[model samples]
Target: MIPPRSNRSQPLACNILRYRDLNRIERMFNRLKLFRRIATRYDKMAKSFLGFLHLTAAKLWLPGFVKRG
Candidate 1:
Protein backbone atom coordinates (compact mmCIF):
# COMPACT_ATOMS: atom_id res chain seq x y z
CA MET A 1 0.00 0.00 0.00
CA ILE A 2 1.37 3.37 -0.98
CA PRO A 3 1.19 6.11 1.58
CA PRO A 4 -0.51 9.34 0.55
CA ARG A 5 1.80 12.21 -0.29
CA SER A 6 1.24 15.64 1.20
CA ASN A 7 0.78 17.19 -2.26
CA ARG A 8 -2.05 14.83 -3.29
CA SER A 9 -5.51 16.36 -3.48
CA GLN A 10 -7.21 13.07 -2.67
CA PRO A 11 -5.58 10.39 -0.62
CA LEU A 12 -6.51 6.73 -0.84
CA ALA A 13 -7.16 4.54 2.15
CA CYS A 14 -4.69 1.72 2.62
CA ASN A 15 -5.55 -1.56 4.31
CA ILE A 16 -2.78 -2.53 6.73
CA LEU A 17 -3.60 -6.25 6.46
CA ARG A 18 -3.53 -6.23 2.67
CA TYR A 19 -0.25 -4.33 2.68
CA ARG A 20 1.26 -6.85 5.12
CA ASP A 21 0.10 -9.77 2.95
CA LEU A 22 1.57 -8.15 -0.16
CA ASN A 23 4.83 -7.60 1.73
CA ARG A 24 4.92 -11.29 2.66
CA ILE A 25 4.34 -12.38 -0.98
CA GLU A 26 7.08 -10.00 -2.14
CA ARG A 27 9.44 -11.47 0.44
CA MET A 28 8.71 -14.98 -0.86
CA PHE A 29 9.63 -13.93 -4.42
CA ASN A 30 12.82 -12.42 -3.04
CA ARG A 31 13.60 -15.71 -1.36
CA LEU A 32 12.91 -17.61 -4.59
CA LYS A 33 15.42 -15.37 -6.38
CA LEU A 34 18.12 -16.64 -4.02
CA PHE A 35 18.23 -19.86 -6.10
CA ARG A 36 20.69 -19.50 -8.97
CA ARG A 37 18.65 -21.50 -11.47
CA ILE A 38 15.49 -19.55 -10.76
CA ALA A 39 17.20 -16.15 -10.57
CA THR A 40 19.03 -16.71 -13.87
CA ARG A 41 16.04 -18.25 -15.73
CA TYR A 42 18.14 -21.22 -16.80
CA ASP A 43 15.22 -23.27 -18.11
CA LYS A 44 14.15 -22.33 -21.63
CA MET A 45 10.87 -24.26 -21.61
CA ALA A 46 7.96 -22.78 -19.65
CA LYS A 47 6.66 -26.19 -18.56
CA SER A 48 10.01 -27.31 -17.15
CA PHE A 49 10.58 -23.95 -15.48
CA LEU A 50 7.15 -24.07 -13.82
CA GLY A 51 7.75 -27.66 -12.67
CA PHE A 52 11.05 -26.68 -11.14
CA LEU A 53 9.42 -23.64 -9.56
CA HIS A 54 6.83 -25.90 -7.89
CA LEU A 55 9.61 -28.18 -6.68
CA THR A 56 11.50 -25.24 -5.31
CA ALA A 57 8.41 -23.93 -3.55
CA ALA A 58 7.78 -27.35 -2.02
CA LYS A 59 11.40 -27.51 -0.84
CA LEU A 60 10.85 -24.26 0.96
CA TRP A 61 7.38 -25.14 2.28
CA LEU A 62 7.67 -28.80 3.27
CA PRO A 63 9.77 -28.25 6.36
CA GLY A 64 6.86 -26.67 8.19
CA PHE A 65 4.60 -29.69 7.54
CA VAL A 66 7.10 -32.53 8.09
CA LYS A 67 8.04 -33.45 11.63
CA ARG A 68 11.58 -34.45 12.58
CA GLY A 69 12.31 -36.89 15.33
Candidate 2:
Protein backbone atom coordinates (compact mmCIF):
# COMPACT_ATOMS: atom_id res chain seq x y z
CA MET A 1 0.00 0.00 0.00
CA ILE A 2 1.18 3.56 -0.70
CA PRO A 3 2.09 5.68 2.30
CA PRO A 4 0.16 8.86 3.09
CA ARG A 5 1.21 12.40 2.20
CA SER A 6 0.48 15.66 3.96
CA ASN A 7 -2.41 17.75 2.58
CA ARG A 8 -0.33 20.90 3.05
CA SER A 9 2.41 19.50 0.76
CA GLN A 10 5.10 20.88 3.03
CA PRO A 11 8.58 19.37 3.39
CA LEU A 12 9.62 17.31 6.38
CA ALA A 13 10.01 19.15 9.68
CA CYS A 14 13.45 20.36 10.63
CA ASN A 15 15.08 22.20 13.51
CA ILE A 16 17.04 25.28 12.46
CA LEU A 17 18.64 25.46 15.92
CA ARG A 18 19.73 21.83 15.61
CA TYR A 19 21.17 22.44 12.16
CA ARG A 20 23.08 25.46 13.48
CA ASP A 21 24.48 23.35 16.31
CA LEU A 22 25.83 20.65 14.00
CA ASN A 23 29.33 22.11 13.87
CA ARG A 24 29.58 22.41 17.63
CA ILE A 25 28.20 18.90 18.01
CA GLU A 26 30.79 17.57 15.58
CA ARG A 27 33.57 19.25 17.52
CA MET A 28 32.34 17.80 20.79
CA PHE A 29 32.08 14.34 19.24
CA ASN A 30 35.63 14.62 17.91
CA ARG A 31 36.88 15.62 21.36
CA LEU A 32 34.99 12.71 22.90
CA LYS A 33 36.79 10.32 20.55
CA LEU A 34 40.03 10.70 22.49
CA PHE A 35 39.15 7.62 24.57
CA ARG A 36 40.74 4.59 22.89
CA ARG A 37 38.01 2.03 23.48
CA ILE A 38 35.26 4.44 22.44
CA ALA A 39 37.03 5.21 19.20
CA THR A 40 38.00 1.63 18.24
CA ARG A 41 35.22 -0.42 19.93
CA TYR A 42 37.25 -3.64 19.99
CA ASP A 43 34.96 -5.39 22.49
CA LYS A 44 33.36 -8.34 20.72
CA MET A 45 30.66 -8.82 23.35
CA ALA A 46 27.54 -6.68 23.14
CA LYS A 47 27.15 -6.60 26.94
CA SER A 48 30.71 -5.41 27.38
CA PHE A 49 30.31 -2.64 24.81
CA LEU A 50 26.98 -1.64 26.32
CA GLY A 51 28.62 -1.53 29.74
CA PHE A 52 31.38 0.57 28.32
CA LEU A 53 28.87 2.97 26.76
CA HIS A 54 26.90 3.17 30.01
CA LEU A 55 30.03 3.90 31.99
CA THR A 56 31.05 6.56 29.53
CA ALA A 57 27.61 8.17 29.75
CA ALA A 58 27.69 8.07 33.52
CA LYS A 59 31.08 9.70 33.58
CA LEU A 60 29.97 12.41 31.19
CA TRP A 61 26.64 13.22 32.87
CA LEU A 62 27.63 12.60 36.50
CA PRO A 63 30.90 14.36 36.93
CA GLY A 64 33.39 12.81 39.40
CA PHE A 65 31.42 9.52 39.57
CA VAL A 66 34.04 6.83 39.09
CA LYS A 67 33.21 3.29 37.99
CA ARG A 68 35.08 0.66 39.99
CA GLY A 69 36.56 -2.06 37.86
Report clashes for each candidate as comma-separated counts.
Answer: 0, 0
Candidate 1 per-residue lDDT, tens place, 3-67, comes to: 67878889788787888899999999998999999999999999999999999998998999999
Kindly report which residue stretches of model 2 are placed more than 4 angstroms away from their true locations once superposed: 1-15, 20-28, 64-69
lDDT of 1: 0.90
Displacement of residue 44 (Cα, Å) in model 2 is 1.1
Q: RMSD for each model, in Å, please?
A: 3.7, 10.2
TM-score result, candidate 2: 0.49
Model 1 regions more than 4 Å off:
2-12
State the lDDT at 65 in candidate 1. Answer: 92
- C-alpha RMSD in Å of predicted model 1 compared with the true structure: 3.7
Highest TM-score model number? 1
Q: Which ten residues in a row have the lowest lDDT in candidate 2?
A: 1-10
